[model samples]
Target: MAHIVVLSGAGISAESGLPTFRDVGGLWKQYSVHDLASPGGWERNPQLVLEFYNTRRQQAREAQPNAAHTALAALESQHRVTIITQNIDDLHERAGSSNVVHLHGEIMKARSSVDESYLVEMNDQDIALGDLCPQGKQMRPHVVWFGEMVPMLESAADIVATADVLLVVGTSLQVYPAAGLVDCARPNCPITVIDPGEDVKVKGATIIRKTACAGVPEWIASLKL
Candidate 1:
């Protein structure tokens, strides 16, 4: 079966009502990135950090998978679809795609502040300031923060290197590490870019120049799937 690798980001989730970090009405504008998505932020205000993630997790949970997600999931019937996403949400899995690699950790989980391996499901709707992991350390959102290494980068690159077809969706390829994964694609692999942003570019790629909701389904239709 052909391997289709999808590299997705926040813009795709934005269609589902989950605002991107820079969007005007999202949780991000209410706080500073240093206070909500960095280790220093957690250090200065653990309570704020926890609260920010709790809200984000809640939003993700309530957001339904969009048409782009559903279309990607449907591709699994005829081929192997490996999704490497920069977003922390599980919309792809929720849409029925079996193989997903989150370069950033999942927001629905919690991990020990001091121990990376001590990760587990966050059973509550919110993580209180005093919430502790099994090791007695404060539990922080499993999502990757600024200044932290992306643990799944190499793995995702390997997946991209093996793609029979690669789809760059919703991301502008502006973020590093995750953005750099596109360079790992095989020379002959078919490249497609699906985003309305004029800045979205991939050398030699077939650009759809539309949002994922419109472009992805159109691409799938072309495949007759």
Candidate 2:
């Protein structure tokens, strides 16, 4: 089966009623990135950090997958579909996409502050200040903070390199590392980018200027796969 590697971002999740960082009334408008999304912020105010993520996690839990997510998941029936997402939500998994790589880590999980490998599923629970890990250290959201290294970067790049077809969805291609994954694709591989936003400048890419909900299903329909 052909390998279809999908690089998704906040745009797709927005279709499911989740807001993107830059969107109107987004979290960015309410909070400073440094004050809530960086290690330095956590150091200064752990309670504030915990509350912020707890609210976000609840929002994620309330959201349902949209057409775009379902369309991508359906692709697994005909191809080896792999999803690399910058989103911390599990809408892709909820929509039934089996292979997903979350470069930004998952919001529905928590890990020890001292032990990155010691993670636990958090479902819809809030991660309060006193939440402790097995080693007696406070647990923090499993998300990759702004300045932290993205552990899944190399894996995502390797997947991109092997893609028979590359689909870039919902992202503006402005974020680093994740933004660069598209460039890792084999030169000859077919590349498709679907977004409702303004024109994106990806050389040789077949850009579909429509929201993921509208564009993804249309693209799959054309594929006849």
Candidate 3:
């Protein structure tokens, strides 16, 4: 079976009503990135950081997988589908895609604030200010903050390198390490990008200009396998 790797981002989940990190400007008023997403924010006020992610977790739990997610899941029946996503949500797993590598950690999990290895599944529950892991250390959301290293980038790159077909969806290829995974794919592998935004500068990829929910299914339908 052909190996199909999908690189997805917030735009794909945005279709399910989840807010994008960068597009939260007009709706609830704008907040500085250091006040919400950065480690400095967590250090300045752990409670606020917890609250922000709590709301996001609730929103993620309430959100349903859209056509784009389902379309990607459908590909498993015909190919070896490996999803390497920048999203922290479980929407892809919920949609029944077997292989998913979360590059930025997952929202539905918590880990010891001191020991990165002490991770635990959160099961839709919010990580409060006092929640403790088994080691008695306070548990923090298992999200990759602005300055933290992306542990899964190497694995994601390996997956990309072996892909027989690569699909880039919803991302503008703006972020660092994760965005650079596309470059790891074999030069001859077929690359398709599905997005409604203006063309990105990724070399050796066919751009399909459309939204994920509308474009993914149509693109998959046209594929031979």
Candidate with maximal lDDT: 2
Off by over 4 Å in 3: 25-30
How would the candidate models be sorted by lDDT, starting from the highest?
A: 2, 3, 1
| TM-score of decoy 3 | 0.95
lDDT (Cα atoms) of all candidates against the true structure: 0.88, 0.91, 0.89
Quickly count the clashes in candidate 2: 0
lDDT per residue as tens, model 2, 1-225: 889999999999998998765452555477687888899999999998898888788889999999999999998888899999999999999999999999999999999999999999997578999899988999999999999999999999999999999999999899997899999999999999998778577999999999999999999988844
Off by over 4 Å in 2: 22-30
Whichever of 2 and 3 has more TM-score, that candidate is 2
**Which scores better on lDDT, 1 or 3?**
3
Per-residue C-alpha lDDT of model 3 across residues 1-225, encoded as one tens digit per residue: 989999999999999999987665453345677877888988898887788877788889999999999999988998899999999999999999999999999998888988999988878578888898787878888989998889999889999999999999999999998889999999799999998999576787889999999999999998886
- Deviation in angstroms for 16 in model 3? 0.6
